[model samples]
Each structure stands twice: as C-alpha cells, then as structure tokens.
Target chain A: MPMNEIWNRRLKKYQSMLLRYSKYILNDHFVLALLFFAGGLGLAYSNFVRNLPQKAFWWEQPILIIILFLLLHVGKLASLLEEADKIFLLPKDYQMKDYLKLALKHSTLVSCATQLICMLVLAPFILRGLQWSFGMWCTLLVVQCLLKLSCLTLVVTSAYDTNVKQFLQQFCFRLTLLIVLAVGLYLNLILSLLFSLILAVVTNYFFNKASQRHVFKWNDVVVYEKGRLMTLYRFINMFTDVPQIVGQTKRRKIFDFLLRSTSGNIYLFLYSRSFIRQSSFSGLFLRLLFLAGIIIFFSPNYLFSLLIACLFLYLIGIQLFGLYLTFEDNVFTHIYPIDESQQSFAFKKLLRKILLLAWIILNVIAVAKPLFKVEYLLIPVISLGEIYLITGIFLRNYIKKNT
Target chain B: MTLKINGLVGGYSRIPVLKDISFEVNSGQLVGLIGLNGAGKSTTINHIIGLLEPQKGNITIDDIKLKDNPKAYKGKLAYMPEMPVLYQELTLKEHLELTIMAYNLDPADTWKRANELLKTFRLDNKLDWFPANFSKGMRQKVMIVCAFMTKAQVYVIDEPFLGLDPLATRDLLNLVDTEKKRGAAILMSTHVLSTAQEYCDYFVLLHQGKIRAQGDLEELRSIFNDKQASLTDIYLGMTQDGHANE
Candidate 1:
C-alpha cells in the first residue's frame, strides 16, 4: 500500500525484465559485430566531415537544430499502471496522486537522460556548424530539458483526452512551441530562454487543468503502458524469446493462394495459414527479407551480399520457430487426432518453401544488378546450402529444444 | 460405443485434484458431469481428452486406451472446451474444413453436415468470417458446429450452454439428441441443472474432486431421500450434506 514500495516493485520488475533481455541483446558476438559496424560508419563519417569546406552551410545548423528539437517530442510518460490496477486500486484512487507524481518524476528523469545523450551525440555537429559559446551551449541544454519536461507533460495530459480532435489540437500546440524554441535559438539565446520559460508554464497549466478535469482514464493509461511494454518486448523478441508479447494477425489474402494449394493435411494448412496471416512472424520475415534485399542490392561485393542474404535466411528461420508455440495453449490442437510429428514436418515444409522463395527473389535481384557479375551464379548455390543447413540442421535443433 | 474412465487421479501438479474418479458413458447415453467451481469437472474432462495424463487410471474410448493408441482413441471422440478455443486466423469455413481433415471425415458427407449445422446455428452467412469478429455466443457456436460435424463415437463437452442463446441452446440439445439417437455417447459438464436434468439421461455429481452421487433424476432424488426432488434440490442437498460431513 505504500506508494514508494509499489513504485520500487514495478521499477525492479521492469529493470530485471530489461536486464534479462539485455543480456541476450548484448551477446559477445553481436556486440563485436555492432562495434565493427559502428566503427566502420564512424570512420566514414569522420572522413566526410574532415573533407568538408571551412564555412558552415546555411541549412546545416537549422536542420540539426530542428532535428534535436524534434527528438524531444519522442519521450512518453511511463505510468507503469497495468490493466488490473483499475479494479485492485480503484478504492485507493485518491492515494494514486502520490503514485502518479512518482511516475511523472521517473518519466521526466528518464526522458532527461535520453535528451542529454542526444545532445551529446549532436555536440560535435553543433560545435562544427554553429560555433556557439560554451555558455550558450549550456543554455541550450537547459532549454532542451525544459522542452522535454513540457513534452512529457503534454503526453500525460493527452492520455486524459483521447479524442482525436483534441489530441491533434494539443499536438499542434506542442509543435508550435517546438518551432518557436528552434527559431528563437536560431535568433538569440535570451529569446530562447524566455520562450522556454513560457513553454514550461504552459505545460504546467495544461497538466494541472487536465488532472483537475479528468479522473485518470484507466483504459487509456493501461493501453499506453501496454503499447510501450509491447514495443520493448518486440525489440527483445528479436534477440531472445519474450513470451509476454501477444502477436497480432493480418488477413493477407494475397498469400492465401499458397495455403490454398495445400489441403488434406490439417497441420500443413494450419501452419501455412498461420505463417501468412500471423502479423508477427510474417511481418518479421518480410521486413528482414526486404532489409536483406536492400542491403544486397547496395553492397558492391557479391559474396558479402550473399552472406547477408544467408544471415537473414537464418534469422527468418529462427524467428519463425516461434510459430511452433502459436497453438501451444489452444486445446483443440492438442485434441486433434493428427500425429504430433506431422506438425514439425509441416512447419519445416512451410519454412523450406518460404526460404526458397526468398532465395529466388534475392538471386534474381542479385543477377539483375550489375554491381558484381562473375559470382552471380554462386548466389543460388550458396543460398541453397545455407537454406539446407538452416532448415535441415539448425531448425531441427530449434524445434527439438522448443518443443 | 462406450467411453470409460477408471480410477483416474490427476491434477496440474503432483498434488492430485481428481482422486480415483471413475465413470462411464455407454452408447446412446448423455451423462451430465455436474460440479461446482474447483470440483474437478474440467480436470476430469482434461484427463478424458488426454490433455492431462492421469496419475493412475485408464480412459478407453470403445475399448481403445488413450495411451495404447492415442490417434485412434482421440479420433473416436470430440471435445468442446468450457471456453471456445479457436484460431484467430481461420475462418468459419476453414475451421470446419480443418476439422474435417484432422478427423479424416468423408469430405462430401461432412461438408453437407457442416452446412446444415452452420445453417441451424445461423452462421451460414458468415462462412468466410473469422473467429475474431464472432461474439462470445457465436464463437461458442463455432466450436459446437465443429464438434458436431466430427461425428465421433463419443463427445466430451464442458459447459456448452454458458454463452449460448436460448435458440442456440435448443438447437444444440436437438443436435445432441440426434447424435444420441445415432448411438453416440456424450459426457457433458454443466451448471445449468434444469437443462441437464431435462436432457441428460444420467448425472455424475462431483464434489471436491470426487463423484459424490451419480444417477438419473429419479435415482438421484431417491438417493437424497426425496421422491420428487428436482435436480437443483438434489444437488443442493448433496453439497449441504458434504459441508455437514466436513
């Protein structure tokens, strides 16, 4: 019942969940690969910057400043109130003000940290382009923190007013404030500080007015919290299994033809339909495949492109393994008289056909592009090997472990 | 056909929730599984459907043990869960089609029966509609249609009348009657004692994971020492007696 105890409990729960997934995300191989990628990009960026002319371009400072101002809008208030809290904590609703105060503090602090990091990242660009005084830079940081606080307040107040018209009105108001700050900063430091103070007062007024007018919309808060958690879970899902996230489905009738041809075996029909209709697995597959194709199309090295293609194929395979557990809780699946092994066979068959299609698409793209010519024939050959290895061996082990 | 459960003992974990439960559903018999919350009705059904392995017992459908030949045993029976468990992706027609394929039912005959069931349930116009769009009653109706279409030797339905409309409930009872006339065995669990007493040929009263009493209406009334007691009266009397014993 102590508000701080509840806050600490939620914080610890979320922290541990994030830590658990972060361990998987920060795996040695992945971290090293990321470092190499970042290092390569950094080198390219530094070379580009060094080769630049002495005078700063007219648009560079405005563009970077606008981007920094826009970044402040991305922060959300994490209330951490779950759907069940509506029923359980409804009696103690008045006491929730203290809880929400803590939530706001937590959200503001977290947003401030992100905003600081963004400023840090943009520091070199700002210094290179604007040539501002250190005191001015310090003033800019202060204005950004105040702007971020306003944005967070706006996000919280907006949750109370779920009407689309009111939401857009609030959004435009915030946008106007952002633009004012950006333009004021461009013109003079004193004007920007004055604009920030006005924005802070406006934000406080809006927050107070909204809180007084509306009792907390439990559904809106729960939905906002769920959406935030789902986004985190989705990101973590890429690195490791996160069972908390519920997948969505889409009726992709265009791909229904692929399933239509397969009949008689219910497992085949089920798996195929699930693969095409379930948005999470199919969406992940398509996104990864599209990314691979883009990367392959751009990369001048044919072998490296093929490697990227194979890597995506492996990712698709691993990701689709989640589909195996799709019907785990559906008792009808367990009640069905079909042989259990048939499910694995059907899943592998579906994967094989999908991977083959991806391989064909990638091969066609690779051949069509004139980036690298001689090793074009090798694309299919390598892809076929990777596909077989992934589907035949890796998938077999994955199914073994998951099942 | 007879669905026989003998000396069944099982629960979610090591602690047994159903203890030494025994029952049988013979051909043309509709056996109602009556129980309160936490009375092991679902666990008993789970064990019968092979979702939970009994700690010590055998469930045989028409002399075929589930462990001995799972496919054949499972094929012989159809199960409708308390809550409708449907695929979000599959449409009504596709659900029926998939059930047909899984049960290896004759396509033409089963499809005809499915169409009739769909029409009876007023879902004929929503063949292409997915379960996501179906209401609670409609979802339950879909499960009913799928199960009825299977035409298995035994049907194990749990709480079938929960969300059904009166018309759908009557239609379901009619369908069960038809199936019963065709010599299929049914073991249904329900809290609707009036409907159960009206339709069920026999009743198994479960209390605290054990069958406290089981018989037809007249027999149950006699057991409770009341010659003209309704099913509700018998049930209440049995439970109060259980409380007194406790």
Candidate 2:
C-alpha cells in the first residue's frame, strides 16, 4: 500500500462522485441564473472600482489582502477515510504517517487551486486598489501557498489536540501570520517572502513533530471526513434528491400549534406534521420565506417586490415537493387504506397553506414599510395570483412529472 | 372472512421470488408463515400487503382484489411489519389518531381501545412522545398498538417478535389471541419456532419460495411420519429434506 497510490485512488473516487452529483446540481437553468447574478454583480463591482478616489489609503490594501487570506481558509484536508477503514486498516497503523502526509499534500494542492481561483476573482480589486506590479502579485501567490500549507498543517495538528489550548494557540498563530503577511506585503515584499519562508519551516517542524507523537485518531478523522462528505451531500440535496443524505428533524414545539387543528384526514395530518417537524422541508421553507421577506422589504418598487415574493413562493413550492417522497419507502404508507388521490390532495393542501402563509408575511412586511404607497396594495393581489398558480398549476406539473 | 393467496409469484424486482405460493387463513385462525432467510417469507408478505405487485397471481381478502379495489382490500387488513415503520414527526397518540383516521374507525370506540392497548403495552405515559427517541422494542410496541388499534378483518404481521421484550412479546401473543377470539384472521411470519408452534392454529412451512408443507401440528407430524416430533422437529426435517432434494 503505497501512500500516494491510496491518495490518488481516494481522490479520484471522491472527485468522480462529486462530478456525478454536480452534473445534476449545475443544470442549465441554475447555470443561467448564476450567470445573470454574476453579471449583475460584476457590472456593479466594475462601476464602483472605476469611480474610486485617487488617494490610495494604507490600511485598505492590508485589509483586502487579509480578507483574501481568510477566504482561502474555507477548505479542509480531505482525509477520504471511511468509517470502515478503522477496522480494515488498523493493522497498518504504523505506516499511517505516509498516508497522512500524502493526504496533506493532496489537500494543500486542492486548497491551492481554490485559493488561486479566489485570488483571480479578486485580482482586479487587488490590482486597482494597491497598484501592485505583476511580480508582486506572484509573490503574494507564493505567500498564499505558504499560508494555506500552514493552515492545512494546523488543521492536522488541531485534529490531534482538539482542546481549548490548541484552539487558542492556532487562533493566535493564524492571526500572527495574517498580520505579519499584511505588514510585510505593505512594507517590503522581500521581508514578507523571508518571513513566509520562516513560517513554512516552523509549520513543517510542528507538523512532523505532531505526526510522530500522535497516532491517528480514527474516530476524529472519520467524523471529519463524514462531515465533509455530508456538506457536499446536503448541498446536492438542495438541487436534487441525494439518496445518501438522511434528513434531520427538530422538535420545534413552537410550531406545534399549527398542527393542533387537523383536517381529520391522515394524509393531511401526516404531511402537515412532517412539514413542521422535518428540518429538510421546514428549514428550506423558512429560509426561502426569510429571504423573500427581506427582498420584499427592501425592494425599490412594488413590482420588483411582487416579483421577488412570487419567485420565492415558486422556489418554496418546488423545493417543498421533496417532502412527498419522505415516506415512500415506509411499508405502513403502502398498507394504509387511504385513497391514492388523498396523498396528492393532502400535499397540495399543505403547500397551498404554507405558500399562503409566506405570502401573507411578505405582504405584511411590504405594507409595514414607511414608504408604503397606494400601489403597494397590489403586491398582495399579485402574490395571491402567484401563489395560486404555483400551488395549482406548477405543483400539478411537478407531481405529474415525478410520479 | 378469509384472506386468500391464490398464486402469489412476486419479488422486489422483475424476477419472481415467490413461486406460485398459496395459502389461506379463515376467520379466527392464526396461520404461521415460517421460512429461512431469503426463503420468500418477506416477499410473500410484501405481495399480500400490496407493496410488491404479483407478476402471476392474485390475492383477495373477502373476495376484494387489491388491483380492483385497493381501498377496500387495504381497509380489511392491518399489517405489523418486522421493522417498525413509524413517522418520526408524529407522537404515539398522533400515530393512533392517524391510524384511526386512515381506517375511518369510530373515534370513541377506537380511542377507548387505543388507550387500553397503550396501557397494556406500558406506553400510556409516552402518548405525546415521538418515535425519534424510542428504543427498538418500544418502536415495535408502537407499531403493534397501531395495527391492533384498527379492528380490521385480517392482520398481516411479519416477524412481530424481533425487537419485543419478553413482557411485550407475551402481551403481543395475548393480543393476537384476543383478536383471534374476535374473529379476525391472522397470517404471521416468525422464526421463533416454539412460539409459532404453541400459538399458531396452522403452520405453512415455506422453503425456497415454495410451500413445503402446511397443516396442523398432527398433520405436519404425520406428513413427516414422525409421531413424536414437535413442530420444530417437523420444520427442521422439512427444510433439510428440501435441501436434500435440491
């Protein structure tokens, strides 16, 4: 079992899995919407940058560099260790260091690519704000690579000693690196390069020492890997059904009142209760509602607000359709004597109520603003129409296609 | 009323696992469906419960076919599966209420019976509790209560003793006997040979997707020509002989 071989195999496996799911996630509609969003933001950003003041402030450059460094800190080292590895690979524990080192290298490479992309996205801002030479930008990339490696090493160290003291130490170390890099990049590139070299040496020393002193905490590693995998699965679940993702539920006793009044139909009872209790559906509903409320509150015109509200209602309706399949595999559902049409009817009824509730809240928010005018009354009228269309026509088409 | 399976040939996929399996349970009869793992006991139950459609057969409860009238067919039978299928969101009381609603049972009578059944199963205190935190045995008890709460003509129970404690198992057996006395037909599948032998009025020994033998204890013993054999002995002999023949 060579270490690089294991790393390559695991990397390929995860990459392929991610690619397979991402195809579903990055569909044409989503990509088009994303492109429109990015184009809008890009236009705004360029306009803002073009109208910038002539005087370049000292702190702005450092702050921007520090923000870029922080953005690069988003990823974790992909150990790619499954739960079963503990049993299957425990006999090879002594040789686990090579495997871990390979893991570190692979994680750093992946994170470096991510950081490069982020830097590229921010390159215009960096170039315009600081007036830095291209060579200096290259130097910054090198320093970023160093900082990313240090962060990766610290992640490994924290896995070994996940205590308050280790956390504080890592926090202070990262803060120090941020400040040193910021000051060095601002004052002198040579100094920053020298300091980053020292930091890299120190990071490697600690990484090697920790690796030697501590055996692999298989539980922590497995949990970390599972968390990483679940994050991807959860994201993919938002777009399409990820069969591997298990939904979480919350008690949410505050919402129990909504279920106190039942329709005497079991499907209605079940679907309504599931909507309030299951976090997957309920969380999406609340999140979309919150976003809709915010957009409706801040919209410049009544038409825009109405459009935003209706769009969110449509999204909520579409996303909440996943709830219909929640109990598909349960045998009791098949054995229940309820009419087949009752399930669809109950689901539509539940969604209509939920969408109406969202509509009411958004309308209230729209009306409560001090800028409310006579035309604002039409917001609710338009929202009502949208809700009916979404819950009736759109849901019918969705159910027809899915069933 | 009788729950009859004329010729159930079905499985999870296109390939048939149950090969023309046939059985019947008349009113007040408890017929034990016994088999080894992957011996088509679950497939047979799945077909009868209408989860898996039969490729070449028909199942009828009191002359109501599942395909023709699923509502009527499902209304007559209550199933307690091996693994308890419970809603994580619904409380124990809500589960009973939902079952009553699904079956259209009389609220007053069903609620009274439900309360007594909950008390008998020692789940009265947990009426408002959801199944999220329940132990395996407690979940099984919940399913048991829900199934028995609906006074259907036929009870299609699959491996009801898997996760039950001794007291719960005893209570379940008592409930089944009570249901039998109330003139309901029960088709129960179990690996607990002694319990099945003692409680079942008739036994259907399934081996490899086919019925090896089906009869009362005396008939089973006579079929194997073992006058002194117990139900377990007869079952063992049948399965071993099945292997020998294969």
Against the true structure, what is each candidate's TM-score? 0.93, 0.87
lDDT of each: 0.82, 0.82
lDDT per residue for candidate 2 within A129-218, as digits (tens), equals 777777888888777778788887776665454334866786788776777677666688778877877877887787677767556688
Q: What's the residue-level lDDT of A230 in candidate 2?
A: 78
lDDT of 1 by residue, B62-159 (tens): 88998889899999989998888888888788998899888999999999999999999999999877886678999999999999999989999999
lDDT of 2 by residue, B1-246 (tens): 899999888888787788988889999999999999989998888888888888998899999999999889999999998888888888887888888888989999999999999999999999888875799999999989999999889999999998889999999999999999999999999999999999999999999999989999999989999899998898888888988998
> Could you tell me the TM-score of candidate 1?
0.93
Q: How do the residues A167-226 of candidate 1 rate in per-residue lDDT, one tens digit apiece?
A: 677768767666766665568877887787788788778776766655777787789888
Per model, how much of the real contact set is kept?
A: 0.89, 0.89
Report interface Cα RMSD per prediction.
Answer: 1.3, 1.5
Model 2 DockQ, alpha carbons vs. true complex: 0.68
lDDT of 1 at B186: 97
